[model samples]
Target: MLRSVLAVALLCWGADGAVTCRNENDEPVNWYILYKAPHLTSQALTGLEYVYIDSNVMRKMAPSTDNYKDIKHPNGVLANTLRPLLTPIRSMPNNFGFISYSDQPPGCNAMDTFGHSKGVVMVDNSGPGVWLLHSTPQFPFRRDQNHFWPESGARNAQIFICVTLGYSQFSHIGMHLQYIGAFPFEHDIPLDFHQELRDAVNWVKSPPPNNLRKLISTDVNQPFYSIAKQQSEQPKVGDLYVTIAQLLDSDLQVQTWGCQRDRKPSYCVSGIHKVLNIKDIHTVLGNWQPKHDHSKWCVAENPNNHWTCIADVNRATTQYQRRGGALCFQNQRIKRIFLQVAQGTDDCSTLNIMDTIDCEPDPHTPSLMG
Candidate 1:
């Protein structure tokens, strides 16, 4: 039944109509998540290999053969979904619009003041679009460049969450991006579209004075919550994970760039909610420490809450002074996948880990400060 619906939707779109997130097989999907593994062993991994999960996988509640693919492959999920924007065309339709933003843009120096966000938002005037939130820097290069992925992105682990939303949701997304201080390297929002998108593009030039912004998006069948925080001069109110843990009213297990200098220790001071840092991850490829992973995400500790978020910032002290955000949702399967990978945490004594296996340090990997 799911295949039939997707096939019908594909037929309706007719290959070149509305922009949507495509699955591994290039089929249109409502949403998808990809976890690109880092180059753990020089002999086996390329760091471009990733595990994929989409609306179909969620429906089945089971892993599939197509769950794993190469990010550099032309027929892979990343290439399949981004072909419309990256490939050159004689003339673009009037209804199509897009925005590519990143703090570390290709052919440019990384911006410290802008949001640490990176993603592409593509929408059609007819009322459907896709929002791709990711952790890879300098990715999906400017449309004019005709390059989809960057070589530098393959060196570290990354996470990407893409959702297909209706046109009405773009305004809310725009507002969230504005709050995060997103730096749009390339964009084209038609005048006929919502005014907030134009404002988002303009916000990059003249940022607002707001420290944080939050919004709930229900334009689609599912509900998505977004939270954005700007670079604060003081650490008075800039711990993104802590704020999210409090907002959801649940303890969290977070993963981020652990090798960064001045990395903050796991937060257990909040009596109501504790944010523990994930130190080791167990994926299909193999087990690895946080030193080899650069993905940023968090999952609710309690199974009942079922909250999962893919974020753009790290748990490092320097990151607190930078703009960033996260897109969150409540999903049982998604939450489970994130939870299972958390084999060990900074405060392992607080949680039960009798069944967890510690990953041995790789001899080939260079030592880095954590």
Candidate 2:
């Protein structure tokens, strides 16, 4: 399938004067943005964080992006999928960041015959990985960046989902699956945005399903945890040069994409391709996935940022799958872990395993010395 798509991409080459570009099956294509710089920055990080925690921001930019018409409602689907995730973040009082897209509304005119002839889309080498946002408003794509978001007492925190796309000829699917990074962002206390960002990126870039899941599940047994925990515990948000220097030492690379390769600034016809550290930036930009959810961790440095914590958490989740399962999980090296909790019945009351509650005494000293 990818071979066929590549053939089409070859034909669509801007040099060929193909006018309009399409997949092998000839479906109208949309430009997809897979990675953004700094991996975690003020605009990409704080902007989305503010929107997610604030209802006003959520209303204006929850799924912020330019809406296109030709694609029949791409924005709607994309925005809806992300709305739930952003709402909580926007509601936070201190969060901040911005939202934007590479493609304009009604999809872009690949023929280079309409508004912004510079608009274009690109798919990953794999095959429909995931769909984060569409280029159009009906289903626009947006980003969040909160490098210093504070969480005094919070649960059910936000998780980041990074995806890669591949085009298909049979279904005329213009995107394929390459990689998925599912990273949960939480702090031990006194939140450190930079550290969480580093952990999230490294977790996504780590290697596969087990590694990625282990990052979010807080599974101690996972191989990447030692490094992730260590870095996450370190300092973030300090002197710019100092932070950048520290990031480079860890293996993050800074790259620029979405421009011309001909020694000129040209719009990326196949989207953008660059690398950077996973920690430096806030937003998790990239292509969206469709049906499959494949997540894992690999030891690769992202040229889009400057730090090296590339863990992924893509397990192809259906709307149904996300709703089920225990909310809190931890990874343990032990093969089996047993716990004692209360079970539930008619009215609901207890700390049994079935009940899903804990009756253990609070470890902290009495608040009022009771």
Which prediction has the highest lDDT against the true structure? 1
Candidate 2 C-alpha error for residue 37, in Å: 20
Regions of model 2 farther than 4 Å from truth: 1-77, 80-126, 131-163, 166-229, 236-245, 248-370
User: What is the lDDT, from 0 to 100, of the residue 298 in candidate 1?
Assistant: 95
Tell me the spans in candidate 1 whose CA falls farther than 4 Å from its real position. Answer: 1-16, 59-69, 88-90, 142-146, 204-221, 230-236, 348-370
What is candidate 1's local distance difference test score? 0.71
TM-score on alpha carbons, each prediction: 0.83, 0.18
Error of 2 at 273 (Å): 25
lDDT of 1 by residue, 1-370 (tens): 6544543444343255557888767787888888888876753777877777787666432222345457866667887777556643323455667888887677674557677778898877675788999977677754432357777777678889988888778887887778788888888787888777888888643343333333323234557777775455443357788778877878899998756545677877736588888878887766777767768899998767999999988776677877788988888878888888888677824532222123333322212321
Score candidate 2 by lDDT.
0.20
Please list the C-alpha lDDT of all candidates, in the order they appear: 0.71, 0.20
TM-score, cand. 2 vs. native? 0.18
The sequence of per-residue lDDT tens digits that candidate 2 reaches over residues 205-261 is 222111112121111222211111111111231111112324333222221111111
